[model samples]
Target chain A: MEFNDWAILEKRVIGWIRKAADHLRASLSNPLEISEKSAHNDLVTNMDRSIEQFLVGKIRDTYPEHKIISEEGYGDGSSDTNGILWLLDPIDGTLNFVMQKRFFAISIGVYENGRGRAAFIYDVMGDEFFHCLSGQGAYQNDIKLSPLTEIKIEDALIDMSTTWLKPNRRIDQDIMTEIVRKSSGTRAYGAASLELAYVAAGLLDAYFTMRLSPWDYGAGLILLNEVGGLYSRADGEQINILSRTSILAARPGLHEYMIQHIKEQVAEGKFLTEPQ
Target chain B: MEFNDWAILEKRVIGWIRKAADHLRASLSNPLEISEKSAHNDLVTNMDRSIEQFLVGKIRDTYPEHKIISEEGYGDGSSDTNGILWLLDPIDGTLNFVMQKRFFAISIGVYENGRGRAAFIYDVMGDEFFHCLSGQGAYQNDIKLSPLTEIKIEDALIDMSTTWLKPNRRIDQDIMTEIVRKSSGTRAYGAASLELAYVAAGLLDAYFTMRLSPWDYGAGLILLNEVGGLYSRADGEQINILSRTSILAARPGLHEYMIQHIKEQVAEGKFLTEPQ
Candidate 1:
């Protein structure tokens, strides 16, 4: 499809997705049906599955040739990103949504041949949506986001979980400590989609996570690109939209500085372990 | 005053406080008139003092005998909690209000003869008001909250910030590390009022901080007490509402277990200084 056609389709899809999510929120607000997934911290409720199913059905009926990769099992098990692929995280931050009843999001990204073309992140309770069409620009609701400009580390705030600083299976602690000490402030909002949205909104300067799936970050990638932000693996490698990747997305100047100094320091002697 | 009279007063005060907070939120959407306090983190805007002044003025006009203790310098500087004393934190998270425009609260507590009679925690953006009147049940909005009962440390979610976990002037990190490992999860929302409100609501099983002032936790203490939740110094000592104190508020079962093991450990020369 042409760029204009894709933009129109994306706007309509985002509207539908917003309506479906609002419906799900209303249905599950009073009496929620909850369940545990990988662990207690990883909570998935009925609304997650239902929302994913609704999105998948809508996409199937409207765009028959499109493929979907979703958090829930409703999507196809396709490994290729050659055609138009829709990535869906129906309920990002499920634990936050289930326990806190807030701070969760519905994130969707449309990509063509591994290049992100459109993105949408809807913070349900806040009724805020961050959207971007490739080369057009990023927006929150009706307001267009300004392109990220050069900001020093001391003037910038980084959004990252403290777990990254701990002795986890992801990254080195000493390097993470150096990064934290350099930034003005560090925050972890528990939802990757919202974190990405905040990065686009210029509320936060950067965000880095060790383990994240396509569903978690696909939408954010499109928004970041449009707002003059860059995303890469921990070793400064390009993110493969088809799989889980250690990701970092930041403004233009900060991204380069982070990769050369902190990223390299964190990945010292272990760069071979990163994807080729 | 009699219990029925106290109840009536609580209802009226809560309504007035809610109205006052809404007015502040609407009026102070931007920091066009902002200033610095003790430090950059300790932010104060015109609205902070204005809101406190309005509350104190209304309280004195409505009931001339009532005393007021507040963060802003608008209340009487009485040392004793004689008659009805109102504790006010006009904007509990001023840094958040000025910086993020969200994640802040208006905390108010009513005390009679040094005893808490009522508390209100208004999360302005979230539109959640957690409240309690002594002898009555705690509530999030209108729904009566369940009491703290039978929570395992392994299942408990604790509230804390990474800043505290680091070597700080106030707290010993050895015990904090153990607390981190033992709890199911840790969260830092940067707003003490809402954190305490969550503890009262049972969403967060526990919350603690190295230092907190009276205004930071007055309303939270009242709400937690109503739900049979415990709030004390980390060493299991009483917290003086007039002074800055170390805070440890948690569900009854987890509170005792944590204090006995964690707090006592820190006291018994098991301190681990944060990494250099």
Candidate 2:
């Protein structure tokens, strides 16, 4: 990688994100064309499609050699994460887009040779732009983010969807129930990238969720990496990035503590990720 | 009540709340002297005490005959809400102030003869002010909030702390778990008043919490009432201003559905509020 490659790529990615965000912010006044993907709760909107298309178009035109993986069906869907790769979630919280009108985000991560090169998470309504380049500092808008300091689970503020705390197919509900009861507090923003950005920016101590697609998971990993944060599959394994898995991202000590505790729970025989 | 009572009181309350909000925002740059309240998870800050003192001073100086109820020990300790009553949660989400540095709010509600006359919930860092004069529509910042339209539980975006979904002494965990699985999405902002404001602004379809004091409960009720929303105890009973009770606030149809569902669950005997 060239010295100026980071600067140029970061600028171009941010520019595309800002362009898409501007479109989204402006279109809030207009009616959205929405359709459910699988369930009524799982929503997809025209804004999601348009933003994905716009970003994919920009990437394909400028970096034609790049492979794209995205949520809204514009991706190349290459079998492996080789060469240059772009992972995008045009709207991280589609329900938020239609219902809340805020808290939704556009997430993009650029990877080269299966390593993160640059990542951006733009919160469209709030105008909070969280981004980072490999080995450089993470940023929420203009201010550079500080590396996260160690915190205990007792002192930490955790963010995760409440659905995970209920009886679910993903993981044992008791596992998260214990964490929520022990943590300083818990919040659920319903947007993966923004919640992860909050971890990087120190607004949240950690954010863990079950089974996020690559588009929802990739950019957040890069942001956390830039902030000296740690992440793994919730069952304490390495993230495959290509497969949907539980994500647990936190500061150094809390990450390890959570992973170890989760492992201990799994060892207890009833707290495994997959229930029979 | 005088003819000009609503107009005059609304202006004065907004003025005081904004003054308190400005103070909170300006002091955000300074370090807060924070201490745990009941436990490590429950926090209180010098900022909280100081804000309460400031608002209490203002109210007392303005209306000596009126009674004050507040968090952080600035209350009059009045047993009932008879004549002019002022409820204040000088800093809601005190942990957010110390840790996240955002999402905390200054909430104030004025009641005349046990009826809500005016209310305000201001987000200091985000600078969104949710206010209302009873019978005169709610407003989020300068924009007038629309009356909540009917929404189904399946389509509603709900907000509440995830802690309520766990096994607790409050409501049955399965009750909220069912609500979580049925709702389109759920969010927990960690501030009760701000979450209620989001509901009034139509950003969320509903917000429910296990228990809240009158200071945390009053301003939100006024905001919801102004926007034609509904609220009752999570057990489907009328709220008593003097007591800490579970609050189930929502738009018209969804609110009824939740209450009825919770009642049915309670009737099953596994879902009672207090176990024998």
Candidate 3:
């Protein structure tokens, strides 16, 4: 891909996302064939696969050289990560879509040589588009988002699933409870992509989750990067773009404090899914 | 008040709530003078006072014989729970208002001889108005809400602040943790009124909070009552409409199961605030 060619590619990506969102809105009223993937709560609907097909089809037709990674197995099983890669999650919060019918998003990120070039997270119900380029500023519905500044841990509002604070194999419940008790408040919106978008927009101060796939945080990481937000795995290692891992994303100062506390309290060699 | 007077009173109360919502929306753009009350997380703003004054003045002018109770000191300090009582919370989820500038609401409930006559919870920013008259059914922006049916605890989506699941004086941490583990999911939106409105709308299955003032849960209980939802304290006692108490509200069968489990696990006479 040429340097100047990136401009035309972004427009094409955003156009595809908008088209995919239309299909999602149309599926709201009609009956959906729902099934559990691995766990009972891990739901997947037909719309998830349909939207992925629509976007993946458009991408393959336009850029045949690009490789794809998606939630619904739209790509070949391979370990190579040396080309232009597209990470996509057609419906990030599938449970929310299945039960509440809202708070879900379509997330996609374009990477070159494992480096993000463009990202978009479309909130289908709210119709808010949060997107960003590699080094350029992030935007929500064409309005530029301000760069994040330092925030104190005492005043921070952490967004996390309560399951982590409950007894879990990944980490001790007491350790996570201390982190929540020290924060000003907590919210669990049940979507990683939208939760990360909230951190980029400064609506939420931090987000922590036990495990997420590459597609869950791919677009969010790009958006957070442009806004000066920070992210890393539980063990204080850089996140792998091709594997599942625990996540802790926040603004500059608070991330350091939270990650240090997590590292200090995480059990020795007992994390349910360690960062690889 | 006469039987037909209830009909005219409902119109006036709803009208006043809409006007109050407009003032709240306007305050969103203006600078708010904030101060902490009791605790750092317990935030109150200048808009709270101004809105309370506006609504209280209207109630006095229209119904001089009615008694009032409110968050701010707009009502006379008294233990009287008789006559046509009006309970008002000028702004519930004050922290959400001061920080996110959304999710807070103006909550009010009207009662005659300790029985609710009408209730309203208005989400100002989202422009959603949830209201109901006694035995007339609930409505969200003029759309009638359906009556709630039985649901199992395993499929329940419980809404509660994470603080309760942490080490607390009211109940043992393990007890609350069990409830969360059995439930499908949990959310903390930081607004009691909106959480209850979600219950009335069937978006959430149950709501559990340790302590809430009458003003916070007044309108919500009425809205839930019309939809055939159930409520009580953690100790299986009726809620006193004049005092602060622990709240556990859910659909019929789920509430019975949860309250029994809670009563069995809570330490003997250790609940921080018991229902009087």
| CAPRI grade, predicted model 3 | medium
> Every prediction's TM-score for the first chain?
0.94, 0.96, 0.95
Candidate 1 per-residue lDDT, tens place, B11-51, comes to: 77777777887787688645447777775456788888888
Q: Which ten residues in a row are the worst by lDDT in model 3 chain B?
A: B267-276
Model 1: how far residue B224 lies from native, Å:
1.1
Give the runs in model 2 whose Cα sits over 4 Å from its true position: A1-4, A274-276, B1-3, B274-276
The 10-residue segment of model 3 chain A with minimum total lDDT is A267-276
Give the range where candidate 2 chain B is weakest over 10 consecutive residues by summed lDDT.
B267-276
Off-target runs (Cα >4 Å) in candidate 1 are A1-4, A29-36, A149-157, A178-185, A251-261, A264-276, B1-4, B28-31, B272-276
What does candidate 3's lDDT look like per residue over A1-276, in tens digits? 543577788898899999888889988999989988887778889999999888889988998888899999986534667888889999999988887788899999888888888989999988889998888889998999999999998889899888988787676666677788889999988889999999999989999987999989989999999889999987679988998888899999999999888767765443445634
Please give, for residues B72-128, the per-residue lDDT of candidate 3 as tens digits: 989764487678888999999998888788788999998888898899999888778
Displacement of the residue A56 alpha carbon in candidate 3, Å: 1.6
The candidates' DockQ values read 0.33, 0.88, 0.76
Residue pairs clashing in model 3 are none
Candidates 1 and 2 compared: the better one by DockQ is 2
